[model samples]
Every structure is written in structure tokens, then in C-alpha cells.
Target: MSNNRRPTIKTVAARAGVGRTTVSRVVNGSDLVSADARARVLAAIKELNYVPNSVARGLVTNRTNAVALVIPESESRLGSEPFFAALIRGVSGALAESRTQLQLMLVRDQAERDQLTESVATRRVDGVLLVSVHAEDRLPGMLEEMGLPTVLAGRRDAGEQLSYVNSDNAGGATEAVRHLLGSGRKRIATITGP
Candidate 1:
């Protein structure tokens, strides 16, 4: 093999004295290979530093092993909002366990929305996590129509058709008011924004 060429699965199989299928099975943790073959393949992989091609694997499996976190908001809002930061951290940590990649997408305008549509159409991502939903936004419907696995941070309204995870705002507010009343705070007011 050339010095500059990255080692392939074929090279690992050759070095391990096993077939390419054996190498693949071991790499994929299939538990079908013999102990001796598995050991040999592992050793060869370490020696050759053979990194599996994720793109090729995705093509073969028809899964990208990635999900898009679509935020239809401006960069300023994404940066300024603590909610977005926390949401991103939570999503990233969850996806880490599955060895899936997170693609952060911000769609603030028609052009950007079109780009997101194109990406979904291409099957570039396995699923989507949409945040900052509005009642009239058509993205959730579009994603549902495409048959892509999608989750939202919040619902568009009481009649939302898509799956979502949202905090119990009314319940939380009720609890807060109870606490304040218990503390003898007679005057209380609430503030909210979009």
C-alpha cells in the first residue's frame, strides 16, 4: 500500500488474515465472528489505524446517523436566549450516547428555510429536532408530510399534531403564585413575551 493512502477495511482484513466480511462484522460489533478472528481484526485495526467511512456506511444502511436541530430564529436570538443554549446542550448530550452527530440549522428567512427543505428532501439527516415553534409555521407539517422523525421543543398550539416536549408553564406559574401568596406578597403581576 502507498504510504500516503489511508488504510481501508481491505488492508485490515489482509493484515488479519481474515475476509473483509469478518473485519466488517468485528467493526460493527455484530458478535458473529470467532474470538480468534475478532482479536486478529482488532489488532489489525489498531496497527493500520483503519477508520471506517461513515458516509459509505450511511449509503449502505440508508441512515445518516445524524439529526438536525432546526431553530427558526435569528443568530442574535439563538445567542441571547438561555433556553436555546440549554436546549442545545441537552440535545447534544443525549445524541452523544448513540454516536449520532448534531447538525445545528438556523432558518431565519425564506432562503434559509428553502435550504432546510432541501436538506430534508435529500435524506441528509436521520431526524429533526425543531425549536421555537409558532402557530402558523408550516415546518412541522412539512416534516410530518415527509415522514421524517421529528420532535419539537414546544407545541404550536393546543391542537398541535406533532410530538413535542414542553415545560408546564401554567403549572409552574401557579406554584410560583402559591409560594408568593404564602410569603404574604399581596401584590403580584406576571410578564411575558414572544
Candidate 2:
């Protein structure tokens, strides 16, 4: 035994060979479950030290006005890039003005990516605003195919039919180069294509 806090309904379900819903009913003062099964789950919960996640409390109130903002990157990378942080601030500020909560999600694997896919397909969000999209990321493609109301912070590849807001990269570059030329830096070289 690791000697941690007791297990929760979710953990107990895994241990007792039952579904989370069954364990949840038992936990939420439901008398519908069979006494024998409930007892088994209770015992398993006590044996393991799995703390329940915040989902339990969320269930009682039946409210989670949270929107998941998925960013597929590492913490270090996120910190290094002002683009994501600024984008998030704008998104949060806009959402705050509308009195809606935002949930930031950082995808590190297929499971997390899949969750984003499900959210869009089910209209789980009033709208989804994607940022930092690569040229070949599959999530954006899937989201587009689902025809969900999505807004991208970056441009879609080639001919992808999706709604998005993008920075004026080309225009900004042009302005910068023109300024350099006017400033007598005629041999100035500008790097594009990230």
C-alpha cells in the first residue's frame, strides 16, 4: 500500500470491475445499486488510495462553464513564445467580456487530441478558436470536416475551408522591408516562412 488518500468512485470502479456510473450512483446517495456490488466497490475504494477528481463536485451542481483551449506544446515552449500567451490573453479577455469561462488544454498525446475532436463534433463549445496550427496537423482537418463553428488564429493550409483570424504576416513583412529600404538598408534581407 502506498499509504495515500482512499480511492474514489472512478478508481473503485476500475478495481471492482464496474463502470464509473455505477460507482457514482453509489457515492451520490443512490440506493438503486445492489448491496453486494456496492459493498465490493466500497471495499476497493478503501483499499486503494485514489483521490476522486473534481468531477464529483461538478456533478452535484451540474455546471462546468469551462471551455477547453488546446495547445499542443511543451511548457517550456509555451513560456518561450509570446504568441501563445498573447493569443490566450486576448481569447480570455474576449470571453470574459461575454462572461464565459475558459479551460486551457495542452495536448501531449492522441487521447488528449481525441478529446478535442469530440468536443468540436458535439458542439461542446460556443465556438473553438485554434492557434499555432502547423501545416499538417490532423486535428484542424478533422475539426473542419465536422463543420463545427471554429475560428483559427492561424491561416489554414492551401485551400482548407475554415473560418479563422490571422496575423498580417505578409503585410507586416512587406512594411518592415519597405521601411528598411527607405531607411537606406537596401541590402536588408528578410526571413520569411516559419
Candidate 3:
């Protein structure tokens, strides 16, 4: 404990006078372990101050328990947009209930996009949540082709195929236009950004 060398599971098992599997089962809280072995492992863990490595456990379990949130916008835009902030809050709240870690990545151009694609390709995350829907965006298609689970905060258009979390922007626009027409506005225009 003082030599700066980390104590491993094997060391704990040795100190506990039990096999490695017994220690593993005890650490995992498996009922397969007898009462006596569990007690010994617990005592050894305390004596060594051993901590379980969640990352290694994730490797064995095939679940990193993490998801990526990709925002195709600059940091300035992210800070300025209330909608994006609200989207992040909702995403965070949902993930907190499920006990999953969220990794936020900003992809404003091709270079950043490529980096994101590589990270996903390496199986570093379980899934992706994309924001900033654009007509020319290629990330959703690329993520689908790479076999990674992907979703959108919104959609490029009415015909968007990816799963999305969105409100009724079209309906709201229609209601606003109707109100303007009834109020006798001479000219009304809806401008979706180009």
C-alpha cells in the first residue's frame, strides 16, 4: 500500500487465503461464494484498500456504459443557443436515470467529424446522440452505416429517417401564420434558415 504499486485482485485473493475465482465471485456479490470465503475476501479488501476497476469490468461485460452526444456546432453557438442548452439538460436528465455517462463532442467541420467517426468506429461508446439537424448533414447516415445506434435532437426535414427527439415546429409555425393572417397582417413570411 505504500510502495506506489497497486494491489490487484490476485493479491487480495492471496491475502484472503482463497482462489482468484472466489475473490472475483465475492467482489461481484455472487451467491455462489460461501459465507466464509466472502468474509475472508471482504477482510482482505479492507486490509489492502483494494478498489474494483469498473473499466475492466466493462470490458468483460461488453458494456462501457457510456454514450456520446455530438453537437455539430461551434462552442460559441452552443453557448448562445437556449435550445441546445435545453436539449443537453434533457439528455443529461434522461441519462442520469439510467446511470450512463455522457460524452459531449463538438463537430463543426470535416476534421472533427472524422475524429468522431473514428472514435465511434473503435467501439469506444455504446451509442450516439446527434443535435443540429441540417439538410446537408452526413453524420446520421454514416453512423447508421457503421452499425452504431444513433438518434437526433431534431430532423433535417419531415422525411427524416433517424429516430429523433423533437417538438412540433411545423405545427407551431402554422398556428403563428394563421394568427398573423387573422390579425390582418398585410405580409407574413416564414423564414427557415438557408
Candidate 4:
């Protein structure tokens, strides 16, 4: 029977009279489970209203079910930049829905960068999300070669080979200019930042 507290895999295992590993295999849809065990596990899941925690499932499957958001920027930039906040919010919001945890990595210098790279190499995180990479940055290539899933907020350049999402700055500027010209403005001044 379920109560106010949530049910875990162990609870389901006890109810099903199977080992935790067997329960995990069944929950993860591994073919190693036998017919009778699968049936029992399913029954226990239904009876106890068991909701498999993705984090626990990841542990049994040799995965952390966690992602690292690596931002190679100093505290100043992280504090001042609006994009970083927005990026964190968007990623965090989506991850929250899936019960996956996020590890924020703000690498400020070479020492921290080395540490972050070491963590990635040690398989501490399931995947990496890199932001604010320069045109010549090699982190993306290194991560890909290491066989880690990676995503970038924006590309280094037009010839960037990695998967990335880029802003349409030029398109937006062109549209602004066209809007002013269409409105019969005699002159339009463009302002930019350093």
C-alpha cells in the first residue's frame, strides 16, 4: 500500500519478492527478466503505485542521469550577463520536468578548466552542455572525441562542425532597418556596444 511518502524501487522489489537488480532490469526494460518476475514486478508497481526514480535507475545502469552545464566565464560575466541566467533557467526548467539533476560549472581559469575536463574524463557526468565557447575553442572537439554527448549554445563560427543553436543577430538587425525604412524615416542610427 502507498502512503504520503513516495515509493522507491526497493519497496517495489520487496513487494514483488525479487532482488533490486531484477526490479531495476524490469523497470529499465532489459530483456534479462524472466516472464514470471516481470509479471510480479508489474503487479507490485501497479499495486504500490511505484514511480521509478530516474536517479536510482541511472545508478543501477552505470549512468548518473545528470548533465553538466559548463560555462567558461568568470564570476563577473556570469553575474552581469543576461544570457547566462536565461540559459540556466531554460535548461533547469526542462530538466526539472524529467527528474534529472543539473550541475553548474563556472570555470574561471585554467586550473578550474582542467578540473572540469578531468571530471568529464572520469565519467562523472552523463553529458555536457557548453556555452560561451570561442571560435577556436577545442573543448567541444575533445568532448566529442571522448565519446561524451555535447551541446553548444552557439557555434564558434560559420564553419563550426558541432551541434549548436545560434542567435539570428544579423536577421534581427536587418528587420529593424527595414522597419525604419518602411515607416518613411529619413535617417536611422545604429548603436552598438563594446
Best by TM-score: 1
RMSD (Cα, Å) of model 1: 2.7
Task: In angstroms, give how far residue 142 of model 4 lies from its true place.
Answer: 2.7
Clashing pairs in 1: none
Instruction: Write candidate 3's Cα lDDT for 1-194 as tens digits.
Output: 55698888999999999998898888776899989989999999999989877787677667777899999898998998788889888888999998798999999988998899888988888999988858887889999999988988878888888888887877999999899989999798766653
Off by over 4 Å in 1: 1-3, 174-194
Q: Say which prediction, candidate 2 or candidate 4, comes out ahead on TM-score.
A: 4
Supply the global lDDT for candidate 3. 0.87
Query: Which of 1 and 3 is ahead in lDDT?
Result: 1
Q: In each prediction, how many residue pairs overlap at the backbone (N, C-alpha, C within less than 3 A)?
A: 0, 0, 0, 0
Candidate 1 per-residue C-alpha lDDT over 25-75 given as tens digits, one digit per residue, 9 for 90 to 100: 997888899999999999999988899999878876789999999999999
lDDT of 2 by residue, 1-194 (tens): 24464555666898888898877777665898998889987877677854555455456745344555768777888898887888789879988986567878777679888888777666556456677777877777777778765677777665756777767877998998889889888588755446
User: What TM-score does model 1 achieve against the real structure?
Assistant: 0.85
Preferred candidate (TM-score higher): 1 or 3: 1
Q: What lDDT score belongs to each candidate, Candidate 1 first?
A: 0.92, 0.72, 0.87, 0.87
True lDDT of residue 153, candidate 2: 72
Instruction: Show where candidate 2 strays beyond 4 Å.
Output: 1-67, 121-123, 179-194
Residue 21 local lDDT, model 1? 91
Q: Candidate 4 — worst ten consecutive residues by lDDT sum?
A: 53-62
RMSD of each: 2.7, 12.0, 5.6, 3.9
